[model samples]
Target: MSKKSTIQVEKVNAHIVNWLKTYAENAKVNGFVVGISGGVDSAVTSTLCAQTGLPTLCVEMPIHQAPSQVNRGREHIEQLMTRFSNVTTIEADLTAVFENFKSIVPTVPDLDKVNLSLANTRARLRMTTLYYFAGIHGLLVAGTGNKVEDFGVGFYTKYGDGGVDLSPIADLMKSDVYALGEYLQIPASILQASPTDGLFGDDRTDEDQLGASYDELEWAMLEEEQGKSADDFAGREKIVFEIYKKLNASNQHKMREIPVCFVSNDIK
Candidate 1:
């Protein structure tokens, strides 16, 4: 991390926790509901929610989840319960739900297409499950997206992982999330674990789908944010920039609110 980019983990944590308390108080919600994915983003976000002293429900809804993924998520939740009296953990395995959907949904002609659709369905299903729990408890659904994935490349599924009542860390950079995670005393195993969306039958990291690691994508995104020209990059850096641009363009829709039809008064 750059000296200028260094995060004041204490201050940031306080700010986010206060924000959550204020928002939940204003919204008159009971607590927060977050999908615990075993990634640093979720770990940090859930911890921040817990720090608010409100009831924070951490839901682990695994759909055919890998052992490592499940283990990390459970450990994080256990850590949270150990530290915070307000933290509650729930395990809702949706493997059967996903299988039933596969069995019932009309089969697409292509296998790859089917797999992709199912992956997204997994995300939406998890979102649905979270909201179901949240609605009954009068809690707001807290999202775990970071700045790079949420905005830079628009890497989240629309109304799926992207669906939320609040995004506490949507503004934090991926690298800085790690810094804050360390400050929050998140488990080293989770902090060091490879990040995944846990949406596929075969495990694939986010970088595997995005075509560039978070570090390279963040650098390219920073260059764009700083108004640095892509022409300045040479060789591999240029290639990464192109990849970044393509992803940013392709997933731009996910970064925005739902589009509504407009009819101008002049037109009428």
Candidate 2:
């Protein structure tokens, strides 16, 4: 955490906690459930949920060939959950889930896409698991999407990882997430580890997939926020825009509600 972040961390933390509480109460939810992938976004979200005094579940769903890094997710979540009244941990094995799609998942040539599909499967499974538990436990599925992922590379699966009862960190960028993590005094080791999804090998990372570091992403996104023309990513800009379009077009339905009409209920 930097000097600037330290100053605003407390306020940001409080704001998000309050936001989740209000959203939950209004939605008639018991608390928040999150899929913790040992990533920064979910880490920040889980901490804020704990600080919000809401029951939170941080699940780690790992796939095949995953490394010891997968264990970090559980440890980090356990540490964060210690501060809350009720925080549960779950291990939803994705090896079986991925097996269901193993045959067809290999069509993509690039390792990134194949891993994305695998990771996406795990994400959807995690979301489904959240709903199953939330329904039984009377809680809500709290999405951990940050603005950089949500807005920039459009970094999320459609109905899969993107499904949520509510999103608390949707407005903050990737960098701000780390800021909140620090204020909550989350473990330093977890805070410093490279942000990743634990999808493929330990090497599979969100930064590598997005083609930019969180810092650079923050700078580029902030420029867009200021109503300025998009910043120059130069050679990578084409691929970046391509990714943005693909995710935007494919996930548009997730961001929309089904249209419905009343059967002349105007009963005047």
Candidate 3:
């Protein structure tokens, strides 16, 4: 879709809700478990799941999370629970668990490497926590990643945020995700908040690491879809396109199906 392309939120919302319900039924799961990050993607996905009328767990797994981020997460869950009878809010402070994991792992020489590893560990810990609940409740772990992050740029960490039983918004672009969020009447704070993975203790926004805004990234994706070359653009636009290409290339492994080995023997 073009930058100007719009989504029919009502139709898309209904489709996602139905898909969640059908998928959970087919999987023989009782409900869904979602990590509520207080961002538009998670808010929209959780809202859709709650509309399914199945038991939905909005778990806030905060590990060294900023106070503001934690508050937003809690408030969003509270709002969701108040609105949906089947939605429930839960908090799992995995800070101590993360610290324990860090203590056990062999220390790398470089601080940057150690910090990056720690950030990813936080996500994996949250993933593990989500599954722990899912295991007992027989629910699927619903992912909040959008199309640009999941397929285009592969922004999520492998086996971290990437580890999920289902993804409800993986097909929608970031722009479309926001549109759906607005349609759902999600709290203005979450709708207006900058997106973050909540893995980094420093609280850097996604765009901070991405080197481009979601709009620019989405536009580059559209350019790719239209067979437009980056060279066709000039100045800052070209730079943004280059950043998009670089990220997509670097994270390609995360975007593809895991490689496996197959062997066959022939009799002599």
Best by TM-score: 3
The weakest ten consecutive residues by lDDT in model 2 span 1-10
* Candidate whose lDDT is highest: 1
TM-score, cand. 2: 0.79
Q: CA shift at 69, candidate 1, in angstroms?
A: 0.3
Cα lDDT of model 2 by residue, 1-268, tens digit? 1113333877777887888888888878778778877667777888778776777877776766455466667778778766675787877776776788676644767877776666677667777787887888888888888876776656777666688877888888776778787777767777888877655555857777666666665655555556644244455544444445555466555556755866776773
Off by over 4 Å in 2: 1-7, 103-116, 230-268
Model 3: per-residue lDDT, tens digit, 127-223?
9999999999889999999999998898988999899999999999999998888899888898788888878887799999899988899999889
Error of 1 at 83 (Å): 0.3
In candidate 1, which residue pairs get closer than 3 Å at backbone N, Cα or C atoms, i.e. clash?
none
| Candidate 1 accuracy as lDDT | 0.90
C-alpha local distance difference test of each model: 0.90, 0.71, 0.89
- Which digits, one per residue and each the tens of the lDDT, describe model 1 over residues 86-193? 999888989999999989989878999988889999999999999999999999999999999999999888889999999999998898899899899999999999
lDDT of 3 at 2: 38
Q: Candidate 2 local accuracy as lDDT?
A: 0.71
Q: Which candidate order results from sorting by TM-score in descending order? A: 3, 1, 2
Regions of candidate 1 where Cα sits further than 4 Å from its true position: 1-5, 265-268
